[model samples]
Target chain A: MSYLAFQLKKVFKNKLTPVCLAILLLLMGTVLFMNVRTNPQFSLQAGAKSEIAYRQKEINRQQRLLKHDKQKSKTEVYHDTKAAIKQNQDAVKQDKQVQKAANKGNWRKAYTIMWQQKKQEQTISSNGQDLAGINSRINVEKKLQFFNYLHHEPLPYESQDMPVTGWQFLLQLNQQYLPYVFTLVALFLLTLLLTDSYHQKLDTAQLLPLEKNNLMISNTIAGIVLTLGSFLAINLVLFIVASLIYGTGSLAFPYIVGQYTGGRPLIECISTGSFIIKVIVLQVLTFIFEVVLVQFLARIFRDKLPALLIAILLVPGLNIATMIVEPLRKICAWLPMTYLNAVDIVSGNLGMNYQNVQLNYTSGLLTLCCSILIITIMILLSSYIKYKE
Target chain B: MLTVQNLSLKTRQPILHDFSYQFAPGQFYQIAAENGSGKTSFLRAVTDLIPASSGKVLLDGKPYAKNKRKLFFFESNEWLNVNLTSLDYLKFVKRQWHSNVDLDQELDLLGVREYVKVPIKKYSLGMKQKLIVAMYLVSGAEYYLMDEITNGLDEESRAILYERLNNEVTQRNKCIILTSHYSSEIKVNNLHRLVLHKQKMHEVKQ
Candidate 1:
């Protein structure tokens, strides 16, 4: 039998693999249940009502200031309160319109009303290059894109907040915090599998007639396959379950990826199917890099716990560091850890977040491939040196 | 022939000091040592599982590294991966050495056929011992360095093991060097007996 086959057998026979998978499935199930319970349609209605109530309260406060403050400058107070009431009244009017459309199950009309209000606000407010202005522009462009896309396609049975369709749910899960959770989980599983296959069995495996380096490489390959295979199976199950519960959503749904126009934001959109495929490709590359990294660390530390701890400190640790470190933010396009947020990169959210347009799909693919190649070379070189000595 | 020249092992104190010997094919040699005498350590040092303070082992006057597949050594059944089954281990060893030993015959001889398909973790001590013995026989290496392989074997299992080892050594021209505490229980014929005394090997006259 091939050595990889033997290693794979050993990995699957280990009880830890199944146990970790079970826990992961249970966590996903619970999160899905919670998401279904707090449906977004109801939340939108509730949110609009609250916003109208808050605006009414603010208007009442401003009216009291206009009437009771006799000692203050009367003309300035009158104009300020009048402007405040007008703004609050406009907001209240919009909120009521949104609430009415939401009740009628016509989200497209609500988005059109929102787009008109955003256009009015844009005309009144100066269009500057500030972060808030950029964000507002992006939001406006996104609303228009969604409104246009909805004109051709059927209305999304559910909002993005609580996506009922399979494709939307998958996209939502990736776009939100679930990618981070999955990355951490995959890292944890990789650490365990590598530690067991290499560090714990080094002594016994040394006695094998095969070259030590070949053994290490074979075991590493087996570990990656098992780690990826188990995750792939879990994801398949999730996709099937989600699709069965909710209708399988159209993959042609368009998402605003970025702004193509330089000075003023012109929205660039991609299909959901293409976006998801790119995300998976980038994520698989990232996962391979992580597996090699854990093996390399295990070889260096020569113990399971230290190797696992250090790997944790390196893979996800570096990802967290990039968010807080200013220098790292500027250089995120070159760093492999930045690509750990594959979904965000594909969606252009990470690029926008860092104000660095270079952290996109192409850059991420190059950076991850370079990182994996370099680390794999290092591992092989280290193994050779240790074998020779 | 497998040759050991100037091998020295030490942990806090010396275990083997410049111990040298030449093991030829078609012979069964036994090394007897008391508890804590580094019997397992010697076997480990020979396999290069533990780094020796000094010296090297050679097959046909060449470094063991060049012909690693020609020799097989497993210190004990404890080193086997408990997650794997007996068949997995047997096939692994066979492919590693590129051996042509019949796995079914070896399993039947070692009486491991009953639970060969079960994971090693669930096996009893005796069952694991049998499986290890079967692996060694199936390896078909030129030199076999075993460490107390019969520790948990029953009388029937011991008889089967001795018969197989004798045939492999005398008829097949294979070299067998094993360490054991109970030398008298080894019933193979024309066996070369050696004793570990003062961190060195000395031949014993039968």
Candidate 2:
């Protein structure tokens, strides 16, 4: 058998590896279950209703002042309630349930109706240099939905106060969070398969019949395959278990994808399956990059603990660097790690919120591809050199 | 046949310089050196674990690296995956080398036949060493580079290893170069000894 085959067998048979896998499953299950217990719609409704309440109070105060002061004209009272009325009119126009409830002046029901809309798309136009930014966000959504159809990936329904379904549980886990969770587990599995072994130099694998490059490549291939296999296996199990406990829900549910710059937000409703497919593809790309990255660290460090530490730190370090450090904000969008939270990148929020950085799904894909290629070259170059040197 | 032509290595200070040697089939050479004398470094360099500062290793006029399948280097006996069973290790080696060496018989020869299914971590020091020796015996490689494999073997197991080494030299016409020398090796026939002195290889009558 090939060394790769032997490694796969050994990894699966290894005692502690299985326990680690169980821990990952347990973690994912807990988080997913917790999300289901707390309806996300309630939070959205609460926030919107709170804003409306505050606005209504201002309007009442303005009316009371107008009644007491004969010197003040009715124009001032109308101006005070103008902003609140316009906001209410926009909410009512966007959602039918919101319109019905808003006619009765029920801000809470209107907020709930808006959040529970069958589909939600936001359109933002870009007239300046934001054209690329707009396209990138739209691409992420297109790719997400397109790939879902390609891969036949199922997605969960949006979180509401109704009976929670397995699909709904998955839906609540935004693209931003799933990538992190998947990458964390991917890093661990890659550590198990490559970096840890290379770090200790426990085996004279270079002595294997294959060439040094081929050996590293074989190990790389095995690590990626196993990591992906484990990732999918855990997700499949989670989905099935969720399905059993909370019904499969609808695969045909609508997913709202949007692009906004200066123009009205252009939002569209695509099948949930399509949107999830993009998430799966982005995740696969992240896994590939992650596998190569950890292996690169392993070959450089030639010791398990240090390489492992660096790999773990890398995930959050990139985020903290770009987000927390003010100087790095401008270039953060150009980094592959920024796309580590692919959903936010796909939705253009990573760049939109930063305003300083310009990132979209395309930029994310490019950065990831470049990183993988450069790291692969480094792996090949360092393969010919001594592990310690 | 295997030849090391002017093999030299240096880490910080010089360890080995102007090293050259040749070995033919049906012969065994014992290399003995003091601690930090570069016996282990020499083995590691030749096996490509550490790159040599200069010189090249060849087998029958071809670079040894390109034809790595013909040589087996057991760098360290202790640095093995203990999660694997003895049989699993043997089977893995067998598959890699395409060797038809009998697994059960090799285990029986080393008296570790009962623990083929047991994880190597649970084995006594002697047992793990026996497994290491068994892997080399079955590797089917023409040239063998074993570094300090006898560090933990018991007396009877040492005798078994010598017996296997003698068989490789005589019957199989294989070249076995092992680091360190023990008195028990005296029984082996057609054996040569080389000692490392002053950053060089020197042949000594044994």
Candidate 3:
């Protein structure tokens, strides 16, 4: 067997490999169970009921204003009171239409009513008369565009429904949890694999007739293969299980990629499949970055526990730091950990959260690649200098 | 030939100060030293495993780094990754050294065939020792820098190992430098033994 194969065998044979895999599989199973119990399906009737409730509250407030505020203009108060009451009555009538259509399983008609109401809201908000602010206007516009898209190309499953098939389950897992899970698992596996030699008090391979650099490169390749390979394998297993249980869901399901802050466009979207592909690409880069980072830490500390602990803690620490510290948030475009949220980054949510328009998928891709290159060069240089001396 | 020039190694205090030695092929040399006289440190330093306080080690008149394939130094069984099978380690060393030695034959000769597939963690001390020796033999290196390799071996295993070392040196013209606390345990022909004292090597018997 080649050295790399040998290294991989060592990692595979490690007692920790099975333990990590078991934990990950268990977590996936729990997620699957929870998804079954709680459904996130969007209900037009439920939405209309909430809208009616909101309008009723507004009518009550206006009535109270007319009764208590004698100092104000009576005509203005009366006008506000009449408008609020009319709006509440209109909401009640709309709620009845939604309930009647929903009772007949006519979701399309209910959706139409909901969409027309949103269109009106969008018009009023755009006209600057909604009084909710620009963000509210953008939100209404986004929903209107989404409603139009869904009407034209409806999905077999509602876009917001709890994942019903393997594809959706994988997509959901990738979007909601896998970014952090992938990085952390990679961190744990790579750290343990690379630092095993140190913990052993000796690495028999280091005594082989190979250059230190060659050994390091072999180790790094092994670490990447084992960690990333495990991730893909686990994903495949979960996908298969979920797919068998629920027929594979549509790839054409729409995913809103957040409000398009770049221009005056309402919001952007792509097929859920496409969004998932982008996530995988960014995540692969992030994994490579993590493997190198772990190796770098192992080299620095030269102790297994310290290296592993630091690597495990570093991701969450940097993630929290970028979020809580305003200065850090502003500079997060260059911070590699900011991209660990590959789903958020690709979906444009991370960019929105950081308040930095530059933290998108493309920027994250570049940042991760650059970080890998820089750390790799540093590792090679340090190895060269140490051996040279 | 392997040559050491002005080698000084220190840890906590100086161990070997300005020590020098030259080792030639087709000979077996025993390195004898007191408990704290840096015998193991010297072997490690020669292979550049542990850095010397000063000086350089050369193989065939070139630096050791350039001639790594020509030298084999399996420091101790403690270096073994107990999670792996013995065969895994044997194959790794063989690949790294690019050796043509038959691994099955080596395993059989070392009598590790019975537990060759078992992980090192399940092996006895003597079994682990035998696997380490098997790694060295499979490497096919010209210079062997072994440290107390006979520690956990039974008398029969030691005899088999001594016979193998004799053939490598006399027939293959290989050079062997090993350290042992009990010199009486090694019975080989024309063994050149040296004692390490006062941070310098003194030839005791040839």
Q: Pick the candidate with the highest lDDT.
A: 3
DockQ of 2: 0.45
Over all chains combined, what TM-score does candidate 1 have?
A: 0.86
Tens-digit per-residue lDDT, A151-193, candidate 1: 4553543556776667777776666655567666666766665
The runs of at least 3 residues in candidate 3 whose Cα sits more than 4 Å from the true structure, single-residue gaps closed, are A40-111, A124-139, A159-161, A199-205, A211-213, A259-266
Model 2, B158-190: lDDT tens digits are: 877788789888999989888865734546777
Regions more than 4 Å wrong, model 2: A40-157, A160-164, A174-176, A196-203, A260-268, A356-358, A384-389
TM-score-based ranking:
3, 1, 2
Candidate 2, residue B85: CA error in Å? 2.0
Candidate achieving higher lDDT, 2 or 3: 3
Q: What order do candidates take by DockQ, descending? A: 1, 3, 2
Please provide TM-scores, in order, for all candidate models, with all chains considered together. 0.86, 0.79, 0.89
**Against the true structure, what is model 3's DockQ?**
0.56
Each candidate's chain A: what TM-score? Answer: 0.80, 0.68, 0.82
Model 1 clash pairs? Answer: none
